[model samples]
Target chain A: MRLALLAAAFCALAVPALAQTSRPEPGPLTIAKQGSFFIGGREVKSDTLSTLPNFDAAGTITVDQMYVRYQAPAGQTGVPITLIHGCCLTGKTWETTPDGRMGWDEYFLRQGHPVYVIDQVWRGRSATDPSTINAVRTGKKPVDQLPTVFSAGHEGAWAIFRFGHQYPQVLPGMRFPLAAQAEFWKQMVADSAANLPTPNPTVPALSELAQKIGGTVLMSHSQSGIYPFQTAALSTQGVAGIISIEPAACPDPTADLGPYKAVPILVLFGDYVDEFPRWAPRLKSCRAFAAAVSAAGGKAEVLALPEIGIKGNSHMLMQDDNSLYIADILLRWIGKNVTATR
Target chain B: MRLALLAAAFCALAVPALAQTSRPEPGPLTIAKQGSFFIGGREVKSDTLSTLPNFDAAGTITVDQMYVRYQAPAGQTGVPITLIHGCCLTGKTWETTPDGRMGWDEYFLRQGHPVYVIDQVWRGRSATDPSTINAVRTGKKPVDQLPTVFSAGHEGAWAIFRFGHQYPQVLPGMRFPLAAQAEFWKQMVADSAANLPTPNPTVPALSELAQKIGGTVLMSHSQSGIYPFQTAALSTQGVAGIISIEPAACPDPTADLGPYKAVPILVLFGDYVDEFPRWAPRLKSCRAFAAAVSAAGGKAEVLALPEIGIKGNSHMLMQDDNSLYIADILLRWIGKNVTATR
Candidate 1:
């Protein structure tokens, strides 16, 4: 079984002397409740015939909704954590890792925090209307009017995800499980959110989720790193705390920092930022943002894993070999900073 | 909570006198192992620039794969069941009902069967390449070359899914939980399987899954009802049993029944088939197919729920209020007909 193989590999790495012994069986997960729901979608009515071959599109339909799946422990202790995935991925990003390791969602749940994972609008389980694209193909709409839909190729993702500087090349000391590279590629999906509104539908949907859940910690990664800040800017009604991991963009230092001042913030970066051309600038921008927050009488800690004696982390720090080690660091931060609001 | 609302409604219908009392809490599920994996995809090599704004597509990418999520009970006993969703839906169809009730996946798991729910190729968690569409949008490919991607409209799906004769017209005594109509509409998605080769990539992928798991009972619904037959025709390597629920099309009655002769087959139809124009012919075709299979020395049963005194079921029989009642029928059949293979 795949689990057996993973257990063996894990034991060889963690306890070489005890590698020969069989791994202990994992206990069943206990949870008080688990379910899914949609949030912040609006109905769009169309009168024209749809792009579907045999169907007429003369009815109301919902679009731009975010899908949230939640699991709460039997005796919850920590504040609820809402996880927003980056580009080209879905809630699966926080699930079982590429190499079958327990992902952050389960890890956090086991650590007593109710975890809510979301698939941003227009991606994964969150559906998007493709009528425009179909209209373009049918000449009902001009090609120029076609929405921007793109998929990340393996090579591009390899470089951008910081797996290596080039395709098929593993970075030295990188903690990514390269043996499961194929599985990682499976996580790549066609991202259609580029065609959404200026602030993106996900921003409003996330804001609505925060308010709906009363108060919760918002954790984001990569392309979605700025969502929590933007959500706070719109209205910090239920935004209790913010954790941005390896964000591709940070808020402009010149922008008003009032919305973020009251919220505890953590901007985290993995290793190889200084060595990777693309990530180095991102890290610098976040550092400036953190400084701006501090100048505005706010608390913001910009953390680089290497500075904390944690090494060999990639852009996908949560999925790396030392993922739980990083998670422990995050747990400690949450315990100290984030108030139990949920 | 949504669960509380659903529980209250459920109690009102089941036991009117007891509706005043709070519904008992659902006990935690005991799952042995749960995870997801991709199956039956191939590397697609491209030498041209990708449709992405900043990325080159000059590399290998995976497509036409199926995503499967599995959960096994703590002490599994029954044969594994592979649940394939109908058209315009995803694996979410088997997770939680539109009205927030326990889905068939959990019900089957509780019945001691490992449940494997799949997002068919080009749908849900299964990733599809958008390069061709992007090519057309960017003028790199002709509009005619664009893939046939279509999304079902609310009105169209309403009639087709047999929710009613027309939009907003519920069939008398239908069990589709009309109150959650909005939630059901959310299940509609853009289906891109038309872009794939004949027989669809999901056929081979599902067959491959059966083989990989050694053997499994293939339970398919609506559009996917024929997949089990098609998969078996290709190779019955891992197919132990077949349960086709309201298939739009059935295997050709005249086709070779060699592969199906040994496999126990159950073709089930929900209520309103004889009265609904669209479903009337489909039921006829499946009845013919079942008769043909029987004539060819195969065990095939064509079941109409009304005939068995189980009435008021819709096309989405599994999500209906009496869904578990239907599932119980299935469990009894499996107990008698399906031999444990995994």
Candidate 2:
């Protein structure tokens, strides 16, 4: 209904006199290949019983598990795009909005880009042994004894995502689709807590996936931001471009970023960024990192939407009313920057 | 372009065979009466100083000054709607969006509601002598030397308004029109700090204004929320109804709400209310107050947008993309409740 209103308003303004013409139907999406892979593994043994073999054969554990949902048209763009969701969310982030709207996965697919939405190790379809991994890392058994993870409650998300100044008290000019929050929260899942903070274990797995899929554009959100940069640095040939949205942290400012010199990196920020105490400093860090990347001869650009007439966007611009608008900006950036690298 | 595409999509879905029809332009707004008025005042004198005759014959210091901009169509609703802006913002909150879109002021006017936008004492065009007020109230000189107030910078607003999770990091599902931040920030003015927190001085002034405009619906936002409820209680005969949006504080739950028993009240909550630390408890307090009103035989209703499927709104819902949708809801509530009280 809202879309219809927007459309009616637009039509009323744009072509008041012109008669409507037949609209084109979007082509169907085809599944090129959809599957899972176990990329990284290491030997694990009990601290008290070192002689005992692990649960699986070869006395090893493959903790870095990834599940991919691949979709594209018959004559899709040669360059493929890989999407990684932020913490507490899975690949469903790219599939549908919390309010029942189409997500970027379909948008990108319709735009002719082969899309791969993935669930990182221990999330969504990916499986993991948290007890064994936690025990191996800490040399002790789990303390909570709860195997499953927890979702960030709907109320809790209000603050974490900056949806409003305060819960039950929305600020002026907010654009988050209020009706869709229930569905969006429902998509959240419980994953291994340890894996979310430092996704080092999944770095090699992501890098390997990129290599397996050939040259691809890596788009990472929130906690997943570090993975693309690490993946690009590790397997420079596999990453054609990188788009990180309000990434938690940036690459070491002074560290060698030679591998990233050929890849184009774009970091996008939504409106009202300085309200969070952490984001201001984090953005500075990101700027410094981007400067360092540029200084190291990489093509890196940081975009603050407010500076460019985009206002009142939350950190979750992907699911915003103007998500397609921002997505188009990213798509244009990719068109200009990724073509050469590919 | 986005709207056009949306319209095309809707046309395709709704009326595939029918040709487009011309949309009628909205009619112009008719001004009924627009002016300013000074309400409450008291005389002042310095201690141990030689007495000098004050400028006014009444030895007046009108601390609570108010400027009103009233508009209505040729045939308008008899029940007038009085608008009070939050802290820092003036009556312009109803005029236009930070991004140049039409505000609820015009929308409400078109909806046939006689609208009255007010600049509260010491805000907008309503001027006051802060030093005099401070001296009269505190018996000392003004402490802070800052001449004008400063608004939250664009970056600060993101977190302050919960537009994003962090500063410069918009979360997913935000709908704030990103292009208008600069203009919006530019409109924020430095208001009298003394008046914003409590706005105690303006209570009588607002009450007086309500009396002059008989049986008015007092609509207040943010900082102005408390005033409407207080004024409604003070001038029971003048206030027919009250609508508070994301109000900071609620009336004391334990207080005798006899005056309000005759007036209908609606407290509307925008998206992400639980995000701010104060909101959860604040909402509880508002609920308690509403419940107290109900228990005391008054008409009161509390609305949470999420509960009704409206999601992802920020603190500022009036300037939001779907401000009209929320406005219509308020109008409907007013239509049903205000009529009875009137």
Candidate 3:
């Protein structure tokens, strides 16, 4: 009889705890200072006011600038971290998650690190000029000359983000808050990378930002996975460390690995990569790149969450239900590897 | 000796309170749900993949979609509020201020109103096709045919945002956080309004959003001040109330005021308008529009902050130092004027 009663009590306690959808109330946030700025854009002149609809046009315009927002905790002890988002998303990926949980930005801030979140050049708050499109519509430019912009369809993103093999299908044990799937779709935006120059303007702009902040740990995800490596290759001035999460690609293994020898690099992967045809190959490439770094006497760690017993993470690991748990792992890695060169 | 000691104690207590730059720690926030979505965009087809730089450009491309992010408090009581930003800004206008104070979106959510913040069509997260620009750059189109895109210069925004009469000049008693001026400039972005159709695609998208949300209040600022009015003019379907904050323009006084007759309207202006050449005329025009609405049996109130003893406000009233104090007045107006139609 006593055993039966205890069993009943255990079920009662465990069921609700496991089923509860709401997150715990976040503690009060007190920051020393928080603000935003634009960096690394050039002036482009236009004199076609007669064809433009608004009177404000037809002058020197700034294009290809990057927008950055930052928050610093009071009496900070940890090194500053700069977060870059993946494709079809902006800096909001690092903000409050789709499910209302505290984002990685605030979590890191609370952990004593300053966080800088950016919208890549020509995306989000980063400026893009629309003159060419306007000219085409007005018949001054040919219809065939339209720039190619990409917006991910639901099915494509479902597979790409590794929520499932297809849309409306949840990968068993996937850590993504599937109930908040609608919110996840909203994070996708139109990306104009096809219109940018080779190497992309964001790479150089990020390098400039690293120098501007003196030195910052560059953390990127998915589409921007290779940016930190590319930035480091260009100039190691302020590239302290690189954290690449579920990147679509990594640096070429055969490329000069000299720049990465001094700066520590972490290539992170979520679960279910093996299930997706595209992500599986990408993961393999990343592992090979990490191995190349190690072979070149560089500090490189390839962390597959499943291998570490932290399983069921989606492409958006930072936004998953157990995001903080994963963040703690990254924090430990940073503490051991990334020294504040500033 | 007793009197002197009391005075010293008062100074010790009051001085720090007055001069302290930091705001009080924000209380713990609990929300029932939060998410985001895109609405109202058309797919543009392009068969000229050979001329395009990337492989993603050959298919149907979605363009001119508006991005909306929302948060609903647990057991909401107040009407939903839709916040639309002005020129060169996105839905970020309603977010946490650059100076780290709690934003109006959270304030209203805490007050039990669900809040929807939107990036106007072709702005921020809203997708804009870059194909035309790409074509022009590749010499497939003429250079003179380039579309006109506008970006606010720091000096011009200073004057237009009412921070000062000119660049690097303060309007004596302006309440904009001058120390954070750099952050304010960062809010500016490259706007492609010149490429959009007349009446702008955002007008219809907002109307659709209103209908989708059932019934909600439409709140706009500066560049977007006229959107709510225009949306209402098209269809009063789900417009519960309209709040216009220092808009650049208002509906023509002679235009049909019939649509506004059944809806409540609040046209609000910040201080220092009469001192600026550009703003003085705009304020006068708004007052005339409000008077016309009242004359035509519509409920419209034109409020100049200075007239109500609230002084030193800049154009960005929602981001000023005493933004909460101003928000209180808005809340009072909303309480008395807006009735939840749903």
Candidate 4:
């Protein structure tokens, strides 16, 4: 009788455990003080691919573009991922070795979604903006790290940026001048809109390609995460959903994320952030975004991670348990939420 | 002879211990994923600084920022962190049970660097654009109980964003009209440039605030660790260094991160990260960002996290010794790096 009672008690305890969310309850969401690190760069030893591009020509366009290849699942028509590279790296940063897995794309392919990786124009293996690069010759700044219209605490740097924005046409810092920059940007935007690479038919970034391929899911990490908002706002087609790694917060809450109204966004921040904004607070931005989306009657899921140390945790979740969690969320959503049945 | 041998062994151990980072080494940076939450209706709960600026009026501006504040050594400067939130969460998400103090931020503050919290736009109490909000009222999909952009996904909703460009006149909502959105956005873009808020010398995100308030050093648990990248990237004056708790990764390496770069990024991914990016993927983004930045000539440090279910393995690290370990890292970073004394 005593042994039976003990067994019964254990069984009861186990039953309760089965109904739990598996992890401890998380705290509320707040602003975060974090720096932004996006994209990956290839391990290029020599300066061969490092040669800078110029934007100094009167009408020539100096555009920087990144390209990547992501393999898709053979048969499943699922969500597609279009990755954009951030500042200093190429798409290679998202790749890692864990449990002997080959790459993120391969892992995702096995689980379902097709991967479409894109190298943002400028930093990694992509084309560089020559005019900005050659700005060093103008002696304005030692290097051309600052982008046009960027504001910083540095007075001289700010002034230079302001001046450049106003008269970029006349600035002499490129193989192709302001005209080239503008034209290149226009073309890039058009290209992104018109033809998203079809790594697989499900690659949503390529609407036509994805439609032909079927059931595309959209995913981004770091700097590339920003593209989803841009693409969703600009594109004519509908995407399956959005998955973002660590994306940079736009200084203007109302400004940056204004386009994605009903888009399901999944944001996962690091437990211990390294940097905070010089102008505002992190929680402020986070809350503002969440509130804004909810106020618009949209769904926004936030996961404040404690700590799982995947190197690509900030960019790609393929190796991190967080990614699996997100993937599960997607699976659940697709199974029960979206109108498009898998 | 036995006593001498024992003493010799002790000395050998002591020598290596004394030769450590010269300060404290925060707990390892790892990828961890736990719990799920949403950033909904939190906007109605914010402390408003100004009146609701018209989302449609010309010359309107809406800004959302993320930063942090933590308890650090009285004189510490650049601390470390782990951003712990989803795309829709803010530093506040780190707030739970034992109150904000028991929260990750407080835990780190007790250790050294005041936790830098972030509230990303589209989540938490941050602002949102009205035009993007209009997507919820679409004729194609079902509304009500609608997930915010952060929680949901779709290309049509996200298509409105332009990189580095913003519409300050936009408000948050799904009720705004389409034609009105275009006019509103156009007017907003044109008018926004006129009355841009003048930069303030008194405030600089959180670090400067902490510096003025007198503080130094930092540490974090999860997503909060990733915030440093943003803080560092946007800061007029960069941080000395950072010590991460369980650091997150950037986003997809295939995306663009060249715009934001961190010189020295440290990571500590726990074994738990294996299922992270799969679950949250955003964690992977944080890791990828670190890789990209490290590739850009910065220091990228990653470590393994302690196992869970261990006696002292609280995620917040307040009850655990992890916060103290984080404090150690901040001490070392401040003692060695950060040439300019705050």
Give each model's whole-structure lDDT: 0.81, 0.61, 0.76, 0.34
Worst 10 residues of 4 chain A by lDDT: A185-194
* Ranking 1 against 2 by DockQ, winner: 1
Ordered list by TM-score, greatest first: 1, 3, 2, 4
Candidate 2: lDDT of A34? 25
RMSD of 4: 25.1
lDDT of 4 by residue, B1-342 (tens): 523533442332223322321433233221111111112111121111111221111122223222222223333333444333432123433432211113354444444443444343322222232221122222222332122221111111122221001223322321123332221111100001111122211113334433443333233334345444444444524354555555434434555554344334444443333433231354455556566666775555443332211122222333222333433444454445444334
TM-score of predicted structure 4? 0.31
Clashes in each model (backbone N, CA, C under 3 Å)?
1, 55, 5, 308
TM-score of chain A of each: 0.91, 0.80, 0.91, 0.51
**What's the iRMSD of model 1?**
2.0
Per-candidate fnat, comma-separated: 0.51, 0.00, 0.13, 0.00
lDDT of 3 by residue, A104-135 (tens): 88789889898999899888877766555555
lDDT of 3 by residue, B1-342 (tens): 523532442322223213323446665455565556677777566542224232344444566778877777777889999999998887767777767577788778878899998888878877665555555656676755555665665656677788887668888777778886655555666677766876788889889999999889999998788989889988999999999999889899999898888789988888899988878988899889888998888888777776655678899989888787777667777887898777
* Lowest lDDT 10-residue stretch of candidate 1 chain B: B12-21
Stretches of model 2 off by over 4 angstroms after superposition: A1-27, A30-38, A41-62, A130-150, A195-199, A340-342, B1-342
Q: Locate the minimum summed-lDDT window of 10 residues in model 2 chain A.
A: A49-58
The count of residue-pair clashes in candidate 1 stands at 1
Q: Write the per-residue lDDT of candidate 1 for residues B1-342, one digit (tens) a residue.
A: 523533442332333212322334568777777777888777776643255556676666777878888878888889999999988778888877888887888889888899999999888778878777767766788887767776777877887878889888998878888898888777767777667787989999999999988889999998899999999999988898999999989888998889988799998888988888889999999888888988888888777776655667899988888787778777877887888665
Pairs in steric clash, model 1: B50-B57
Ranking by lDDT: 1, 3, 2, 4
Error of 4 at B115 (Å): 47
